[model samples]
Target: MNGVIAGISYRSLLGRRRIWLLVVLPLVLIGLAVLLRAVGNGSEATTVTLMEKFALGTMLPLLGLIAGTGVIAPEIDDGTIVHLLAKPISRPVIARTKFLVAASMLALFAAVPTFVAAYLLVNLESDIAYGFALGAGVGGVAYAAVFMLLGILTRHAVTIGIAYALIWEGVVGNFVPGARRFSIQQWAQTVADQVSSSPFLSTEITIGFAATALLLVTVGAVLWAGRRLRSFSLTGDE
Candidate 1:
């Protein structure tokens, strides 16, 4: 929550070419929504499917990886983290600051766009749009925390993140019934189920389980990232 550190981290995150990925993904979601609406396929069922398969399933995790890693990974890779580490600031503070920046970026690029796209597809009269938006926002924060820790723990954070998002979340989580229980996407869908009255928004995970899992994952990842940052060397060795 250090303003100076958060500001620097925000600028650093937005400066990266990965920001374009952030921008483009949401645009694609919205564009698809527009196309669906134009084609008269913007039913509640369709909206739920699009939100579940594309917004929550795909775009959320990808943006989380970019923002989470972009906040600090580039600096660590280029040896510029030494400048931050040399300051009087504690390692946890730096981790917290960068995490805050990443979360805010997720809120903007992921959550807001999700709401807008859902609204375009199904309007705001029902809870579908709001439910999915809230779920996305919560899920984005959790993803940011997890991926930020990954960035601290490994230089190949992006590679690991892509594998997790695509292989684990997109493929396994979708098709494998047992594996869906462990997915961030499904947890978020449980949140959406609790909010939306739409039967199409149901998940095998209950709201209580989803909320608890999200809380534990986000807090645990941030704390672990802080612990890892404490031992990080100036040479970028952990």
Candidate 2:
């Protein structure tokens, strides 16, 4: 990946106050972890539940949406994307570079906070932290790629992304057992379940299946986004 393209992507994401917007979710997660632990009101079950529900589930997806869409959508909206696309760099490289930047931001804002929250909540069970940290890391990358593709495909990326995350992943996963197979949260929980030896932690999807699905989705979305970028039409073709 070109460092210049990566740098541009990073600045475009972080230079705006929008990056700070992502901080709210992680900070809330951490604050809840601390408050629960400090108040002596949290049990292992509560810790795991909070981490799975709020930290891993909510924060990871939210950060991914912001970083993923933030990197590319504004550029496309403001017509700055043509400037980048007009350069000598391959579209795939540009897409990959932006993916890396969004993934990195997710790691910092989403995954790291997940680790810290787990530590505060379930410090005795180190594997819980490790599991969710790895889970969040992988899940964040997947979410970034997916949301980035959505940005390329639609003007209302954030709205659609949130609906998918909360409605499809959260609600449907709870009600429809079959839907769990396709939910990113389940795939993430599968990764978490593998790393965490806790019997209480369970995933509907097998680790192998979830890992494979994640790989296919992340790689496929970025490649497709690259293709879209290659033939991107600002006049109306998007």
Task: State TM-scores per candidate.
Answer: 0.97, 0.96
Candidate 2 local lDDT, 68-164, one digit each (tens): 9998988887888877777788889988988988889999998898988888877848488889989999999999999998988888998999999
Which window of ten consecutive residues has the lowest lDDT sum in model 1?
10-19
179-198 in candidate 1: lDDT tens per residue?
98889999998898899999
**Candidate 1 local lDDT, residue 157:** 97
Best by lDDT: 1
Which candidate number has the best TM-score?
1
Whole-model lDDT per candidate: 0.91, 0.86
